[model samples]
Target: MTKDVIQTIKDRASVRAYKPKEVPEETLEKILEAAHLAPSAGNIQPWEFFVVKNQAKIEKLTEIAYGQEWMTQAPVVVVICTNPDLSAAKYGQRGEELYALQDTSAAIENMLLAAEGYDLGSCWVGAFDEQQVKEVLELPAELVPLAFVTIGYPEGDKEEVRPQKELDEVTTIIN
Candidate 1:
Protein backbone atom coordinates (compact mmCIF):
# COMPACT_ATOMS: atom_id res chain seq x y z
CA MET A 1 0.00 0.00 0.00
CA THR A 2 1.22 3.50 -0.85
CA LYS A 3 1.81 5.87 2.05
CA ASP A 4 1.07 9.56 2.32
CA VAL A 5 4.06 11.43 3.74
CA ILE A 6 2.14 14.00 5.79
CA GLN A 7 -0.20 11.40 7.16
CA THR A 8 2.71 9.17 8.09
CA ILE A 9 4.31 12.05 9.98
CA LYS A 10 1.04 12.85 11.68
CA ASP A 11 0.50 9.23 12.64
CA ARG A 12 4.05 8.78 13.95
CA ALA A 13 4.16 8.29 17.69
CA SER A 14 6.23 6.35 20.21
CA VAL A 15 5.07 2.74 20.35
CA ARG A 16 6.18 1.07 23.55
CA ALA A 17 4.15 -2.13 23.67
CA TYR A 18 4.71 -4.73 20.94
CA LYS A 19 3.47 -8.14 19.90
CA PRO A 20 5.72 -11.21 19.80
CA LYS A 21 5.85 -11.24 16.01
CA GLU A 22 9.22 -10.66 14.36
CA VAL A 23 9.74 -7.99 11.77
CA PRO A 24 10.21 -9.46 8.28
CA GLU A 25 13.70 -9.18 6.76
CA GLU A 26 12.46 -7.20 3.76
CA THR A 27 10.61 -4.72 5.98
CA LEU A 28 13.70 -4.24 8.11
CA GLU A 29 15.74 -3.62 4.96
CA LYS A 30 13.31 -0.94 3.79
CA ILE A 31 13.44 0.77 7.16
CA LEU A 32 17.23 0.73 7.05
CA GLU A 33 17.17 1.99 3.50
CA ALA A 34 15.14 5.02 4.61
CA ALA A 35 17.70 5.70 7.31
CA HIS A 36 20.54 5.33 4.79
CA LEU A 37 18.88 7.90 2.57
CA ALA A 38 18.85 10.52 5.34
CA PRO A 39 20.93 13.66 4.78
CA SER A 40 24.47 14.00 6.11
CA ALA A 41 26.86 16.89 6.39
CA GLY A 42 28.89 17.27 3.19
CA ASN A 43 27.48 13.87 2.15
CA ILE A 44 29.78 12.27 4.73
CA GLN A 45 27.53 9.63 6.27
CA PRO A 46 29.25 9.04 9.59
CA TRP A 47 26.64 6.68 10.98
CA GLU A 48 26.48 2.93 11.51
CA PHE A 49 23.27 0.95 11.97
CA PHE A 50 23.39 -2.18 14.14
CA VAL A 51 20.46 -4.59 14.10
CA VAL A 52 20.15 -6.53 17.35
CA LYS A 53 17.85 -9.56 17.52
CA ASN A 54 19.49 -11.65 20.21
CA GLN A 55 17.25 -11.88 23.25
CA ALA A 56 20.18 -11.95 25.67
CA LYS A 57 21.63 -8.78 24.21
CA ILE A 58 18.25 -7.07 24.18
CA GLU A 59 17.80 -7.90 27.86
CA LYS A 60 21.21 -6.39 28.59
CA LEU A 61 20.23 -3.30 26.66
CA THR A 62 16.98 -3.09 28.63
CA GLU A 63 19.00 -3.10 31.82
CA ILE A 64 21.12 -0.28 30.48
CA ALA A 65 17.94 1.59 29.61
CA TYR A 66 17.09 1.79 33.32
CA GLY A 67 15.34 -1.55 33.38
CA GLN A 68 12.61 -0.56 30.98
CA GLU A 69 10.98 -3.96 30.72
CA TRP A 70 9.04 -3.03 27.59
CA MET A 71 12.29 -2.83 25.63
CA THR A 72 12.97 -6.48 26.22
CA GLN A 73 9.71 -7.49 24.58
CA ALA A 74 10.41 -6.01 21.18
CA PRO A 75 11.41 -8.40 18.40
CA VAL A 76 14.32 -6.24 17.30
CA VAL A 77 16.31 -3.18 18.21
CA VAL A 78 18.19 -1.07 15.71
CA VAL A 79 21.00 0.83 17.33
CA ILE A 80 21.97 4.02 15.56
CA CYS A 81 25.65 4.70 16.05
CA THR A 82 27.86 7.54 14.94
CA ASN A 83 31.55 7.69 14.07
CA PRO A 84 32.92 11.07 15.17
CA ASP A 85 36.32 10.45 13.65
CA LEU A 86 34.70 9.91 10.28
CA SER A 87 33.10 13.34 10.58
CA ALA A 88 36.41 14.78 11.80
CA ALA A 89 38.15 13.41 8.73
CA LYS A 90 37.03 16.40 6.71
CA TYR A 91 35.46 18.96 9.06
CA GLY A 92 37.57 18.61 12.16
CA GLN A 93 36.28 19.57 15.65
CA ARG A 94 32.90 20.98 14.67
CA GLY A 95 32.18 17.98 12.53
CA GLU A 96 33.17 15.55 15.24
CA GLU A 97 31.11 17.24 17.92
CA LEU A 98 28.04 18.39 15.99
CA TYR A 99 27.64 17.11 12.46
CA ALA A 100 28.00 13.47 13.36
CA LEU A 101 25.25 13.75 15.96
CA GLN A 102 22.97 15.71 13.65
CA ASP A 103 23.42 13.18 10.85
CA THR A 104 22.57 10.24 13.08
CA SER A 105 19.53 11.99 14.57
CA ALA A 106 18.17 12.57 11.07
CA ALA A 107 18.64 8.90 10.29
CA ILE A 108 16.84 7.96 13.47
CA GLU A 109 13.82 10.04 12.43
CA ASN A 110 13.82 8.38 9.04
CA MET A 111 13.76 4.95 10.68
CA LEU A 112 10.78 5.94 12.81
CA LEU A 113 8.85 7.34 9.86
CA ALA A 114 9.63 4.33 7.75
CA ALA A 115 8.40 2.02 10.46
CA GLU A 116 5.15 3.96 10.59
CA GLY A 117 4.76 3.65 6.82
CA TYR A 118 5.18 -0.10 7.02
CA ASP A 119 2.46 -0.39 9.70
CA LEU A 120 5.09 -1.53 12.15
CA GLY A 121 5.51 -0.15 15.64
CA SER A 122 8.68 1.55 16.90
CA CYS A 123 10.11 3.69 19.68
CA TRP A 124 13.28 5.76 19.71
CA VAL A 125 15.17 5.08 22.91
CA GLY A 126 17.84 7.57 23.93
CA ALA A 127 18.33 7.11 27.64
CA PHE A 128 20.96 4.47 28.32
CA ASP A 129 24.38 4.14 29.95
CA GLU A 130 27.01 4.66 27.26
CA GLN A 131 29.70 2.37 28.67
CA GLN A 132 27.25 -0.39 29.49
CA VAL A 133 25.65 -0.23 26.05
CA LYS A 134 29.06 -0.38 24.44
CA GLU A 135 29.96 -3.42 26.48
CA VAL A 136 26.75 -5.22 25.60
CA LEU A 137 26.89 -4.30 21.92
CA GLU A 138 30.66 -4.86 21.81
CA LEU A 139 31.14 -1.53 20.11
CA PRO A 140 34.58 -0.13 19.39
CA ALA A 141 35.99 2.98 21.07
CA GLU A 142 35.26 5.44 18.25
CA LEU A 143 31.76 4.28 17.44
CA VAL A 144 29.18 5.95 19.67
CA PRO A 145 25.70 4.51 20.08
CA LEU A 146 23.43 7.53 19.97
CA ALA A 147 19.95 6.06 19.95
CA PHE A 148 17.86 2.88 19.46
CA VAL A 149 14.76 2.11 17.45
CA THR A 150 12.83 -0.84 18.83
CA ILE A 151 10.63 -2.53 16.21
CA GLY A 152 7.75 -5.00 16.29
CA TYR A 153 4.07 -5.36 15.48
CA PRO A 154 1.83 -3.32 17.74
CA GLU A 155 0.05 -5.37 20.36
CA GLY A 156 -2.90 -3.00 20.62
CA ASP A 157 -4.10 0.48 19.75
CA LYS A 158 -2.05 3.54 20.61
CA GLU A 159 -3.48 6.21 22.86
CA GLU A 160 -4.22 9.68 21.55
CA VAL A 161 -1.16 11.89 21.80
CA ARG A 162 -1.54 15.35 23.26
CA PRO A 163 -1.98 18.04 20.68
CA GLN A 164 1.19 19.59 19.39
CA LYS A 165 2.10 23.18 20.16
CA GLU A 166 0.86 25.76 17.68
CA LEU A 167 3.23 26.41 14.78
CA ASP A 168 3.62 30.09 15.69
CA GLU A 169 4.85 29.14 19.14
CA VAL A 170 7.67 27.02 17.72
CA THR A 171 8.49 28.76 14.47
CA THR A 172 9.59 32.22 13.33
CA ILE A 173 9.77 34.04 10.01
CA ILE A 174 12.87 36.18 9.68
CA ASN A 175 11.84 37.77 6.44
Candidate 2:
Protein backbone atom coordinates (compact mmCIF):
# COMPACT_ATOMS: atom_id res chain seq x y z
CA MET A 1 0.00 0.00 0.00
CA THR A 2 1.04 3.58 -0.54
CA LYS A 3 2.32 5.50 2.48
CA ASP A 4 -0.63 7.89 2.26
CA VAL A 5 -3.09 4.94 2.27
CA ILE A 6 -1.34 3.44 5.30
CA GLN A 7 -1.42 6.79 7.09
CA THR A 8 -5.11 7.15 6.34
CA ILE A 9 -5.84 3.74 7.84
CA LYS A 10 -3.81 4.47 10.94
CA ASP A 11 -5.54 7.80 11.51
CA ARG A 12 -9.11 6.53 11.26
CA ALA A 13 -11.18 6.50 14.44
CA SER A 14 -14.88 6.02 15.12
CA VAL A 15 -16.18 9.47 15.98
CA ARG A 16 -19.41 9.74 17.97
CA ALA A 17 -19.42 13.51 18.52
CA TYR A 18 -20.05 15.93 15.65
CA LYS A 19 -20.60 19.60 14.82
CA PRO A 20 -24.05 20.88 13.83
CA LYS A 21 -22.96 21.91 10.33
CA GLU A 22 -24.48 20.05 7.41
CA VAL A 23 -22.40 17.96 5.04
CA PRO A 24 -22.49 19.34 1.49
CA GLU A 25 -24.32 17.29 -1.12
CA GLU A 26 -21.17 16.91 -3.22
CA THR A 27 -19.07 15.66 -0.31
CA LEU A 28 -21.69 13.15 0.75
CA GLU A 29 -21.87 11.92 -2.84
CA LYS A 30 -18.13 11.38 -2.86
CA ILE A 31 -18.36 9.24 0.29
CA LEU A 32 -21.14 7.21 -1.28
CA GLU A 33 -18.99 6.80 -4.37
CA ALA A 34 -16.31 5.25 -2.22
CA ALA A 35 -18.84 2.77 -0.88
CA HIS A 36 -19.93 1.96 -4.43
CA LEU A 37 -16.34 1.11 -5.29
CA ALA A 38 -16.09 -1.59 -2.61
CA PRO A 39 -15.66 -5.17 -3.85
CA SER A 40 -18.57 -7.57 -3.93
CA ALA A 41 -18.80 -11.35 -3.99
CA GLY A 42 -19.13 -12.77 -7.53
CA ASN A 43 -19.45 -9.15 -8.64
CA ILE A 44 -22.97 -9.19 -7.23
CA GLN A 45 -23.51 -5.84 -5.57
CA PRO A 46 -26.42 -6.21 -3.17
CA TRP A 47 -26.18 -3.06 -1.12
CA GLU A 48 -28.49 -0.06 -0.90
CA PHE A 49 -27.64 3.21 0.82
CA PHE A 50 -30.17 5.51 2.52
CA VAL A 51 -28.74 8.94 3.22
CA VAL A 52 -30.76 10.25 6.16
CA LYS A 53 -30.71 14.05 6.45
CA ASN A 54 -33.94 14.66 8.34
CA GLN A 55 -33.63 15.59 12.01
CA ALA A 56 -36.73 13.73 13.20
CA LYS A 57 -35.63 10.55 11.48
CA ILE A 58 -32.18 10.92 12.93
CA GLU A 59 -33.70 11.35 16.41
CA LYS A 60 -35.81 8.27 15.86
CA LEU A 61 -32.66 6.42 14.81
CA THR A 62 -30.97 7.54 18.00
CA GLU A 63 -33.84 6.04 20.01
CA ILE A 64 -33.74 2.88 17.92
CA ALA A 65 -29.99 2.67 18.46
CA TYR A 66 -30.36 2.43 22.27
CA GLY A 67 -30.34 6.21 22.75
CA GLN A 68 -26.85 6.92 21.49
CA GLU A 69 -27.67 10.63 21.40
CA TRP A 70 -24.56 11.34 19.34
CA MET A 71 -26.31 9.97 16.28
CA THR A 72 -28.71 12.86 16.37
CA GLN A 73 -25.94 15.40 15.96
CA ALA A 74 -24.61 14.04 12.71
CA PRO A 75 -25.56 15.83 9.49
CA VAL A 76 -25.87 12.57 7.56
CA VAL A 77 -26.54 8.97 8.49
CA VAL A 78 -25.91 6.52 5.66
CA VAL A 79 -27.90 3.37 6.24
CA ILE A 80 -26.24 0.49 4.40
CA CYS A 81 -28.64 -2.30 3.67
CA THR A 82 -28.05 -5.63 1.92
CA ASN A 83 -30.29 -7.77 -0.18
CA PRO A 84 -29.70 -11.43 0.55
CA ASP A 85 -32.01 -12.46 -2.24
CA LEU A 86 -29.88 -10.56 -4.70
CA SER A 87 -26.75 -12.30 -3.50
CA ALA A 88 -28.49 -15.66 -3.33
CA ALA A 89 -29.47 -15.46 -6.98
CA LYS A 90 -26.08 -16.91 -7.69
CA TYR A 91 -24.43 -18.30 -4.52
CA GLY A 92 -27.49 -19.70 -2.80
CA GLN A 93 -27.45 -20.24 0.99
CA ARG A 94 -23.90 -19.06 1.54
CA GLY A 95 -24.62 -15.89 -0.40
CA GLU A 96 -27.75 -15.18 1.59
CA GLU A 97 -26.27 -15.98 4.98
CA LEU A 98 -22.76 -14.62 4.69
CA TYR A 99 -21.64 -12.94 1.47
CA ALA A 100 -24.22 -10.18 1.52
CA LEU A 101 -23.24 -9.07 5.00
CA GLN A 102 -19.56 -9.49 4.18
CA ASP A 103 -19.86 -7.26 1.12
CA THR A 104 -21.77 -4.61 3.05
CA SER A 105 -19.02 -4.56 5.67
CA ALA A 106 -16.39 -3.83 3.00
CA ALA A 107 -18.54 -0.97 1.76
CA ILE A 108 -18.82 0.44 5.28
CA GLU A 109 -15.06 0.45 5.70
CA ASN A 110 -14.62 2.31 2.44
CA MET A 111 -17.11 4.93 3.59
CA LEU A 112 -15.20 5.47 6.83
CA LEU A 113 -11.90 5.90 5.02
CA ALA A 114 -13.37 8.27 2.45
CA ALA A 115 -14.87 10.43 5.19
CA GLU A 116 -11.49 10.55 6.90
CA GLY A 117 -9.83 11.65 3.67
CA TYR A 118 -12.20 14.61 3.50
CA ASP A 119 -11.41 15.62 7.10
CA LEU A 120 -14.87 14.55 8.17
CA GLY A 121 -15.65 12.42 11.22
CA SER A 122 -17.43 9.09 10.87
CA CYS A 123 -18.86 6.40 13.13
CA TRP A 124 -19.98 2.92 12.15
CA VAL A 125 -22.99 1.90 14.23
CA GLY A 126 -24.30 -1.68 14.39
CA ALA A 127 -26.22 -1.62 17.64
CA PHE A 128 -29.83 -1.09 16.63
CA ASP A 129 -33.10 -2.95 16.35
CA GLU A 130 -32.98 -4.28 12.77
CA GLN A 131 -36.74 -4.52 12.44
CA GLN A 132 -37.23 -1.03 13.73
CA VAL A 133 -34.65 0.36 11.32
CA LYS A 134 -36.45 -1.26 8.43
CA GLU A 135 -39.79 0.14 9.55
CA VAL A 136 -38.42 3.60 10.17
CA LEU A 137 -36.68 3.73 6.80
CA GLU A 138 -39.68 2.21 5.04
CA LEU A 139 -37.40 -0.32 3.43
CA PRO A 140 -38.45 -3.08 1.11
CA ALA A 141 -38.42 -6.61 2.61
CA GLU A 142 -35.56 -7.61 0.32
CA LEU A 143 -33.27 -5.02 1.86
CA VAL A 144 -31.95 -5.82 5.35
CA PRO A 145 -30.34 -3.02 7.35
CA LEU A 146 -26.72 -3.95 7.95
CA ALA A 147 -25.01 -0.90 9.41
CA PHE A 148 -25.14 2.89 9.95
CA VAL A 149 -22.39 5.40 9.17
CA THR A 150 -22.78 8.86 10.69
CA ILE A 151 -20.86 11.71 9.07
CA GLY A 152 -20.03 15.30 10.02
CA TYR A 153 -17.27 17.60 11.22
CA PRO A 154 -16.05 16.53 14.65
CA GLU A 155 -16.74 18.69 17.71
CA GLY A 156 -13.41 18.19 19.52
CA ASP A 157 -10.38 16.03 20.00
CA LYS A 158 -10.67 12.24 20.18
CA GLU A 159 -8.31 10.65 22.66
CA GLU A 160 -5.97 8.13 21.10
CA VAL A 161 -6.79 4.53 22.00
CA ARG A 162 -4.17 1.81 22.05
CA PRO A 163 -4.75 -1.42 20.18
CA GLN A 164 -5.86 -4.24 22.50
CA LYS A 165 -3.18 -6.59 21.17
CA GLU A 166 0.23 -6.33 19.55
CA LEU A 167 0.45 -7.03 15.83
CA ASP A 168 2.50 -10.20 16.40
CA GLU A 169 -0.18 -11.63 18.66
CA VAL A 170 -2.93 -11.21 16.04
CA THR A 171 -0.98 -12.49 13.01
CA THR A 172 0.04 -15.97 11.95
CA ILE A 173 2.39 -16.66 9.03
CA ILE A 174 2.96 -20.07 7.45
CA ASN A 175 5.62 -18.94 5.00
lDDT of 1 by residue, 1-175 (tens): 8489999998889999999998999999999999999999999999899999999999988999999899988999999899999999989999999999999999999999999999988999999998888888789999999998999998888967967899999999999
RMSD of 2: 2.0
Error of 2 at 130 (Å): 0.5
Task: For model 1, give the 10-residue run with minimal summed lDDT.
Answer: 154-163
- Please report, in order, the local distance difference test score of every candidate based on alpha carbons: 0.93, 0.91
Write model 2 residue lDDT over 8-82, tens digit each, in one string.
788889998999999989889988998989999998988999999999999999999999998999989999999
RMSD of 1: 1.0
Clashes of 2: 0
Q: Where is model 2 more than 4 Å wrong at Cα?
A: 1-3
Q: Estimate each model's TM-score.
A: 0.97, 0.95
Error of 1 at 89 (Å): 1.5
TM-score of model 1 vs. true structure: 0.97
Error of 1 at 103 (Å): 0.5
